[model samples]
Target: MEFLQILDSDIRPGGLIEWIPAAPGGLGAWHRDPRGTSHNHEQHLRSAHDYRRATRREGGREAWLGLAVEFDQQIDFPAVQGALLAWINRHEVLRTHVRLDGPDVARYTTDPGTVLLRRSRIGWYHDPRLLIEQIAGSFDRATTPMHWPAYRFATVARAGSFTLFFAADHSLVDGYSLVNAQYELRELYQAARERRPAALPPTGSYVDFSSSERTAADAADDRHPAVAVWREFLGGADRLPPFGILPAPPTGAGPPPAQHSHTTLLLDDDATRALTDRATALGGSLIGALLAVAALVYHRHGGCRFTTLMPRHTRHHVEFHGALGWFVALAPISVDVSDDPDFALALERTMVSLDRAREGASLPMLRLAELIGIPPEPKFVVSFMDTRGVPGAVEADAGAAVALRSHTYADDEVYVWFNRTPGGLRLHSRFPAGGDGPGEAGLAAFLNEFAHLLASIAAGG
Candidate 1:
């Protein structure tokens, strides 16, 4: 049995390595945090708790894997499980976690989560009635994170048999990882059931890549492009912008469900083609166009300019770029939403800024915080990514698949995020539930208007 090795992201080279044993019941998992020190760990947990507790003002609030196949032909559990494991093995990050203490301590995964191969009719019960109830139950009972750990997976019985699900802490994995895992699991399961050889790829270990990345970051004399982008865009703008998106709730109030619901906008082949063509014409990429609209929405909401933090994987150029460990650099960039008429040109500028931040990604988050004079806990953070890995490319499956989806917590003060999928582009905004911030309806309406404005831009309206 392979064991999952957990590591602390914040630990410098030659740090201490602490090993925690996994619990029984075939629920094999562990928590790998970015902060290795006791102080940072406590602070991170507190931040997560606060995020969950503050959801009532704007709306309601707070916030898996497995394999098994139907005995029948339709749902292939074995295949899916096999594929997922293969993918995990293929991606170095999934296989490794930060070791708390060690010389050059990095991601190591001797322990992989338990993989159960079982038969069930749970998946085949596509009856709308049963399906909806089961899904609802899963949603209701699923544990929302009170803290940020590595990743997690769970499954439950609905109606006749059982259904498997994956619940991972977002801080550890992103949307692309989940999708790839799913694909790998499916492939692995099918091959096993059929008694055929599984064709798994050769992926590097997360530890190797992470340590290498730190080395590269430290060695690079240049600042990450994203940070540079932020510095240039801010151009003397306030590092700490005013908090106007939502207000905090009064003390001693019970937590409420967050009002911010996520929605994905798929740009079909035609739409993707049209948007990309126009974007190129306007001197921007698809991401540039999306940023323009997002800026517009932010401007309309508060007339304030703020930084949008994006995660860039540093696994690149390392031996284990595809590995599953947290080797990402978060660069928070501010776009001057208050200026410029041509949204395209504005997006181009933002893109340029992103480049700078990436270049200087070797600077640790804590170091950046110190340099910027911002605490770990800031106002809501808005992130944007072009998710081309999952459900990306209309040509992949004839374009009928749902490409883009997002999960965000209003538990913290943060409100919105923007992303791109195969279908189109989506703007995911999370508003406060209680009195902590804005509600989903208001945020949605705001996005709707902004979308229309972008449409006009696309149509030259």
Candidate 2:
């Protein structure tokens, strides 16, 4: 799926139609679930910090993930409302509320039927740019980690078509859940129109997953192997891995630079398939080959080694795959490319580095941090997710699905994701903005090199 900002999105202007959740009734007192994990609690602190820092800086907001979808048919209010409410009821995570307790986060949940949405016609927008700015601001204010009902749903309605937008705090959802949500929501809307039950699989509750994981992780201590694995990976490094490819701003000259993003077409479908076969024939997987390509590029640019944190999902079962929640663990992967080895040897080192993933994601990042004495921010992440098998992601992307966590204000944070889409293998990165003009050009140059290296393997060079 293409994760993007609304500024990068293609949306038409229209009258706004929002199905807003009413004030939750019968909410039990916010009490800490001892079964709760530290992941969300840690994020709450980070969000608070980001919000305060962002208010002083320019365009940035706290962490929120979102998706924008298109509807080209005539409006159907009743069916749409039914579909939205049914969707909210189906996901137990949506039925809950969160608030910051003294030192921890507390949550209280209501039964399915209690959560209801009231329809409102917000306004009309003729200028698409103004509409975009308005929606982005609305989303930034709508979902906050410290508030109850941390998600909002709205549709920018047109004559015979509309674009539906949904935004939720990052603590409530992840990229996977947002991508799949398009499929489920459409099915629910159709079923609502027909007055039939939506044919959806039984989804496991993230609440239960959190409780079980919290209890299970309570057994971990300093002697745990994951602890050792994380401790070694960090090596007393506090901030994220440095960007040897880009120039850093003058030290202490000012606040950290704002961030920008770049996405490029690495290879077409035919070349991607050939490259996959080539990697297989070389006794290395596609992921390993891609990592080798990146390591080579990093080393070519006067780097000592290539190192990054990778995200691994905690959804071990099929059921959790369909749920909306932040269920992920971070693992460290570093490779010594200073030897200047060729693709074969680099792939070998890449494979060895990947072995770290097995243990790094085994524990929650918070627990890993407590074990290793490092905080969670300032992380340099490089992740590869082979999502070619995921049904409906292309359709969702066609409908303008965006991740919406952009407009960040970090100085040294960079996130890179390699996705195996149905079309081809592609990588997108968010790095230091470096004040815009030269930053964009430099990232493009860097990614072009990355693409050529992959193309070399695909063409048997």
Highest lDDT, which number? 2
lDDT of 2 at 350: 82
**Per-residue lDDT over 155-195 for candidate 2, one digit per residue giving the tens place of the 0 to 100 score:** 88878877778888777887778767877887887799899
Instruction: Give the poorly placed runs of model 2, Cα more than 4 Å off.
Output: 24-34, 38-41, 45-60, 236-258, 397-403, 435-442
**Among these predicted structures, which one has the highest TM-score?**
2
Taking the tens digit of each residue's C-alpha lDDT, what string does model 1 give over 345-404?
Answer: 567766775566565444555444544533565455555555556322333233212222
- Overall lDDT per candidate, in order of appearance: 0.45, 0.73
Clashes of each: 91, 0
lDDT against true structure, model 2: 0.73
Count of backbone collisions within predicted model 2 = 0
Which regions in candidate 1 have their CA more than 4 angstroms from the true location? 1-164, 215-244, 264-267, 301-306, 318-321, 360-362, 370-372, 387-412, 415-417, 434-442
